[model samples]
Target: MNAGNTFEVEVRGIRREAETVRSFELWPLGAESAESAESGEAYELPPFEPGAHLDVHVPGDLVRQYSLTNPHERHRYVIGVNRDPASRGGSIRMHDAVTVGSRLTVSAPRNHFPLNEAAVHSVLVAGGIGITPLLAMVRRLCELGRSWDLYYCARTESRAAFLRELRELADTCPDGALHCVFDGVPGTAPLDIRAVLAKHGAQADFYCCGPTPLMDAFTAALADVPPERVHLEYFKAPEISTPANSQAFTVTLARQQKSFVIEPDRSILHVLQEHGVAVMCSCREGVCGTCETAVLAGEPDHRDRVLSPEERAANRTMMICVSRCKGDALTLDI
Candidate 1:
């Protein structure tokens, strides 16, 4: 991450939202200083829309993207982190080493999963930690007096983060409703996404963020829905098999007037980094939009989950971390 493009924040408070989930409240440096306390006023941070995320630079030299959970109008940014046993160090560090008053670097907000503010009604589906982004959407929708329904799925109620807050919000809004489904409970059945969609009707815009299985089910259920009416974001890249016939390709950096050869086994990102190229990158697995580079020429074999189908068809930009040139050579804006 670029130091000039990031902000320094202090952890103001932390709460255990669930057994494995911890929510951190962050305030900009000096926001909670004696001056603000004496003045009894709040200090504002950079504005962001709902569904935005921050590239938090954590210990172990790892950068992980976590969605903002609070309303966009807030003075502080809130993020919930879930301790994953299979984590590659980010979440574990957040849960174990981080604490109140710890200073952290975070990039300004970026939103690939923006809520459609114009939609008359919205349906939000969340699985486990996926609720982070959707919670912000619900808060924004409520503020706008828009109708929305949320379907929250978790292994059990005890494992659901922000469950009490969601329920409280639902009770405050007559136009909004909340549904919970715990599949791990003995008597409970898994959420029937198809049935849920059917009951909600086709006019409501749908949004989902969850594990691979839930994401797959939600996507399949919305196969007939219009692209603009469906929204989703992935916390990690799906397990996709790379094409067996990938061939060597040459990439030309238009601005730098430099060229490099990319092997079939190596990623474009790795090749660029090896050549001393500076690119802002986080999740190299193609889940984060950090390594997205403008495509000046040639068709790209898109592999990232961040871009929509329409965007992929346009071939205007490609995530260099996992995507590559379709032909023998390609040009990039660098």
Candidate 2:
């Protein structure tokens, strides 16, 4: 989707999965609605790549990133949000205050880790909420008649959001290819990543998205494979490695006409927010592109996972969450 285009949408529906998780359905407002309806509109926003994600601005000064879980042909945008009690306030606000009629601003979809071209056979592994992007990939693979398999692991069957749908899709495949591994199943064992890899490794491309521990295990277990053969998309950015004797810095928002002194222990985004500067952000770890802004003047110490090498070379956009200004004073577009 175009980076410049944005939409104002209202929550059309909300469904709670558990105490901490919820699914939200949104629709575009005003004339865009009529235009979409006329064209048999599926998504309120532009069609996105299979693994694309969007930045959602929630109430209580919260901005978060969520993967688009619905197929590209669907009429509405769907996101599954898991509330984190330890979160700064984003997830809590989303679960508590967001309702069927609540309104929010959403940025266009962004894809930093698009599917690779050499993926002849696909193997998708998902854990819990990590299934969002993989669900879209499954749909795309099915439509293309590509060889694919999905291994979905959850704490229990009831906790899996689209268990029924996944099972049906698996049944309809040319050959049975879906495997469900429940953590608490009486008879079934936990997911055996090694066994799965041993059987699927030769000609398949492995794409994994999950929690930190799961991803970490996959990384360690798959170390023998070529890096290009394995793909990963994280819901959170990698942690920053602090340097010795790092000093504080100054940041200037050229558009907003504001400036702030950011301590070494604080992130630029946190410092800006503390000063009451309105900035958009999600996935504060830096994987999501919601908090990205244009760099007007200064060298940026790029630390985010979303920007491409070319995008970074251009030095135009920067993810404010984890990225820092390299120079003593930095200017931003706000």
Per-model clash counts, in order, read: 0, 2
**CA lDDT of 266 in candidate 2?**
92
The residue-by-residue lDDT of candidate 2 on 136-223, one tens digit each, is 7887777666778899888887767666667777777663378878887788777788888898889788888888777887777787
Q: After superposition, how far is residue 225 of candidate 2 from its true place, in Å?
A: 3.2
Q: Judged by lDDT, which candidate is best?
A: 1
Error of 2 at 57 (Å): 2.2
TM-score of each: 0.94, 0.79
Lowest-sum lDDT 10-residue window in model 2: 29-38
| Candidate 2 lDDT score at position 202 | 90
Error of 1 at 59 (Å): 1.1
lDDT of 1 by residue, 1-334 (tens): 2333787788999999998999999887776653573343445566678888889999778999999987654457899999998978899999889999899989888888999999979999999999999999999888998999999999999999999999998999889999999999999999998998898855899999989999999999888888889998997888888798799999999999999999999999999999899999999988889888999999999999888889999999999999988899999998
> Model 2 TM-score?
0.79
Query: Which candidate leads in TM-score?
Result: 1
Instruction: Estimate every model's Cα lDDT from 0 to 1.
Output: 0.89, 0.77
- What are the RMSDs of all candidates, in order? 2.6, 4.0
